[model samples]
Target: MQIPEYQLFVHPSDRNELRKNIWQDDPITAKLTIGKKKYAIDLAYRGSHIRDLRKKSYRVTFSKPSMFRGAKEVHWNAEFKDPSLLRNKLSFDFFEEIGCLSPKARFISLKMNGKNEGLYLELESVDEYFLGNRKLPNGAIFYAVDGDANFSLMSDLDNKVKESLLVGYEKKYGSEQDEVHLQELIFMINTLPQEQFETEIVKYINVEQYLRWLAGVVFTQNFDGFVHNYALYRNGETGLFEMIPWDYDATWGRDVDGEIMEEDYLRIQGFNTLTARILAIKTFRTHYKNLLEDILTNKFTVDYLKPKIQELHDLIRPYMQQDPYVKENLNVFDHEPAFICTYIEARGNYIRSQLDVLE
Candidate 1:
């Protein structure tokens, strides 16, 4: 089936206002239509650099969650840095294939004021609704909005607060004002002795599930995800934290700025404070190694992923050609999929070789 279309209409004055405050979180009213259904939405410019770009990313919050596609909030990613326009979609697909809670994504054509904005990746917001969709219990979800929330108990570079190490995380679910639970988790991670870390960590986190999510991040080579670009949720039933991957446009052998990354760009150890501690435990390290091996053998190899990449590339090729933002350079769109295939093969090999030396 062809990708769906989004028609957004904003009054000239409101649009101008949004344009003026694109760097800020100010949202303006807009009318959004999909198929024959219409919605009233508060549209705000999203992302850091992309907000200043011609084809901008946006955060669309519907008046009600059920208003459109049963989602209260959604993001339209410009994918400006990624020429292939497949990094986020492919990365999330891999995460789902490996059984992680990642946001659902759709490739859609976005038009504003009847002008073609470009091909955008529509993503589901990770909120209570997302947890419900996964049949997961509603709990606290925090977004690592800045670089400092790298799961470390140490104060941020700015030295925010020692007691509340939740400096960079923005609470998306549960009580925004409460930092006690989050701080406790951090305290355990930082202060717990190495001998008791494994036992204590599992009490506050789904250890195996977290290892799987960590594997996804490492395999995808998403450097940003180790510290930022993830949502941490406390499961209501288990009272343990789990990770949800987000903003994967910087993955699959690409750095956050979309530059080509080295095949071994991320080390298996010392990526972050939490991960370093986890890997320090022999049993946990062995478990993580086994997971990595399983993925490389079964799912992450070129033989398994090449066809999938080809299928997605073929499906989106025509739309990529029509996208005005992508018109500046056609070569990258055409060749990047092949580059990805090569990257997958090389990355898998590199990880396999480095596993023994990681400790």
Candidate 2:
């Protein structure tokens, strides 16, 4: 695949000032060029690594709700620490293939003021536009911005203020700031009796889709995504909330910081309270096991992913080899694909073995 080119033009003074500022919300005026089209956009530094890197991830928002390739906004990720540079794209591919709602992504060549800023991954922003494109019900969208939003009712109680339950969640949509609906969901998850939990839960959340999303996270070992790095949307039609995976650059045998993680670093439980509660139930446990088995047999196996991984590697290799900002060890660039392939094989086998003895 030929990587698309994106050219950004910003004031030299503003660019220097932004380098000194750590805030991600401070936007500067910029003009972006993609193909033959040009757009006036507000560019801002984004992500926790904003202060740690020269080439930073950015959030680009147009002056209007104009659609660029069917997206109103785009998140340009530097992928500085990832050697493979395919984690986010590959994870999203898996989610989409498994029938989960996820953002679209592509690798692109980025240039700032005619200087090659290196290869960046352009991801579709999960906003009203994304909801409309996926044809999913548009409702309240909340981002799990911090660790406190771990689906634990205890975290909610620790903050007596009614609005505190949403402390770690950033509401991306919906007008009312009130936490009534979110509070009710947490209350039910914590206090509901085991027998009634399953039936009652579905009234407020999509349990099947949630389980599938959880399987994706566990299979890919996205530790950060379990408790955080996700979006929760209350379906307008069914009034039930659903989970959307996000920030997967750290997945597939690596931690968020891009350090290698043990293949079995995540325990089936203790990652999120909701998942633990659901797995504790015999019926839900069986359902989850079945889902995992089907995923491993059909979707998550090495035989299925090897060629896909190779395809991505081949597509991104030329650009990645030329990117000077990549921080991974030189040797890692050559060996990382093999490592990912090995992870798929090991993780699938381990999960299957664990499922057999889970009782």
Mind giving the per-residue lDDT tens digits that candidate 1 earns over 297-351?
9999988998888888888887888888887667878888889988998999899
TM-score for each predicted model, relative to the true structure: 0.96, 0.94
Measured by TM-score, how close is model 1 to the native structure? 0.96
Cα displacement (Å) at residue 254, model 2? 1.4
lDDT of 2: 0.81
Model 1 misplaced stretches (Cα beyond 4 Å): 64-66, 156-163, 176-178
Give the C-alpha lDDT of model 1.
0.85
Q: Write the per-residue lDDT of candidate 2 for residues 1-359, one digit (tens) a residue.
A: 69998898988998987877767578898988888888889888888854477678999888743668777788999877677888999999999887688889999999999888888999998888888987877788888888778776555335443445566788888756325788778778878898888778778788888888888888888887866889998888888888889889888888877888887887654367788778777777788888888888999988899999988888877777677686345468778889999988888877877886446
lDDT of each: 0.85, 0.81
